[model samples]
Target: MDWGSTPHSSTMYIWHLEGLKKMDLRLRAFLAPLLFCLGFIPLWGIDIQALVQEQVKSAGLADQLVSVTNQMLEGAIDTGKNYQQVKQLDKLYQETKNLKAILNPNKGASKPTGLGAVFKKAIEPPVDLDKALNLTNALQKEVKNANQDGLDYSKILSVLNQLENSLQTALDLKSQWLDTRKAN
Candidate 1:
């Protein structure tokens, strides 16, 4: 069979090209308004770099809290247990308070306050917002319990570990989100 003599093949090829052209037109038509609406809407329009930086700062503060708590635990083990525990509990309280202030600057305050408060205002919530909040609250309660009874150092340490984990998780999620957004 001679290739040029096949009229049916030429017709089929023309039909395929026509079909592709139609599909291309339909896709463009569907995407035009969607792209336009996306342009008008601001979803992740905030400066993600700033948000990531804030999360990093929060994570650093949480790390400090963890370090101090570990020191306190060592002190309790080596020195006067009750006195050392009380002092460490106070320090933990202050560090956790600062962490909370960083996490939720608007809480119990007239307005945002901190180095990254303005950026925090615009930043979207991390994937683990609820988890972070609950863990932070649990940490506070554990600190309160430790302060009141001066018992169960193990329990306090466990709660501090959980809080630090949550903070680190949030920081990781936020950083990943920022990296993805930047790549796009």
Candidate 2:
């Protein structure tokens, strides 16, 4: 019980006795897993945060919406295929534009036309306007609950797929409508 200096413990300290003893393999085996779990505890929070944030970062939920919206609007201004869909959706066009603006506040909402953006546009498989609109609305919902937990991204993604298909359908129908009118 004497920690420092005492007549009864003058030869050696009590703490040193543990170092002199042989540790059991059973204890070492059990402690390894426990120590690893303890060591990993701090990382769980970080990984969860990173996952949630990743789902909304560039190429994440938010960025995916941006890419899709750009395609919709550009298609509207260009070929007039799904121009009406872009004009009339579950949300307003201005709102979609505003939400896309928040992709990178530091960049002042300028459109992403860089090489990476171009490559992504080229490589990204077809995907939605209403679903794109839903994501835009979710992003602007509260700016706090703008993640997977607060948003039904699966449904949004599903709707995105539906939207893509619908656009393709519209183009097919229009092309067919025009074919019937070809004067030969």
Candidate 3:
């Protein structure tokens, strides 16, 4: 039968049936994870190295941010050791990593938080700390782009809001680090 010349409803029914028959169990298994990932798309992707470079603005200085972040992270780890809160530091580190994933979804590890919880803290929403730094870097770019493009301020404000919580968390970590140093 010439399915193309059939009535619209009949055509759709035939196609649907054919499509279902063609779909194998293996295909369904593959599509299950694919659809699950597609459902969790983030708003924007960022480049971590570019962002660090932009924010710090120096030749070959992006590593400094990594060093600083690592130092601060280590300090947090030490604090955890002192307070028997190593769990907290581990949690913070994982969260920071998750934040980085959010900020730089492109370069960020594609491993979904699900079934990938083999880390310091295995029971929290995927938060990327690297992304926090990237967010700041991304905003710097956005501001420059906005100035060049004359985009509305509302978009900038929205980006700022998205990072507000992460920024606060970063600030809190800095403060704690500072206070710990002072105490030492």
Q: How close is every model to the real structure, measured as TM-score?
A: 0.39, 0.31, 0.25
lDDT of 1 by residue, 6-113 (tens): 978788788889999999999999999999999855655444554556556555555556566666666565755677566756666566656655565555645557
Put down candidate 2 lDDT per residue, 1-184, tens digits, no spaces: 5546677574565545655553556678889999999997776555444433432342244445545545545544565444344453223334545544443333332446779678655754333334444554454442333233222334435434543443344344445545755799
Best by lDDT: 1
Q: Model 3, 52-146: lDDT tens per residue?
A: 43333321222333343345447656544443333433443454444444544444334565556455236435334445556555544544443
Question: Cα lDDT of model 2 overall?
Answer: 0.46
lDDT of 2 at 52: 32
Question: Candidate 3, clashing residue pairs?
Answer: 96-128, 96-129, 97-128, 97-129, 98-127, 98-128, 99-127, 99-128, 100-128, 100-131
Quantify all predictions' global Cα lDDT against the true fold: 0.62, 0.46, 0.47
Residue 78 C-alpha lDDT in model 2: 67
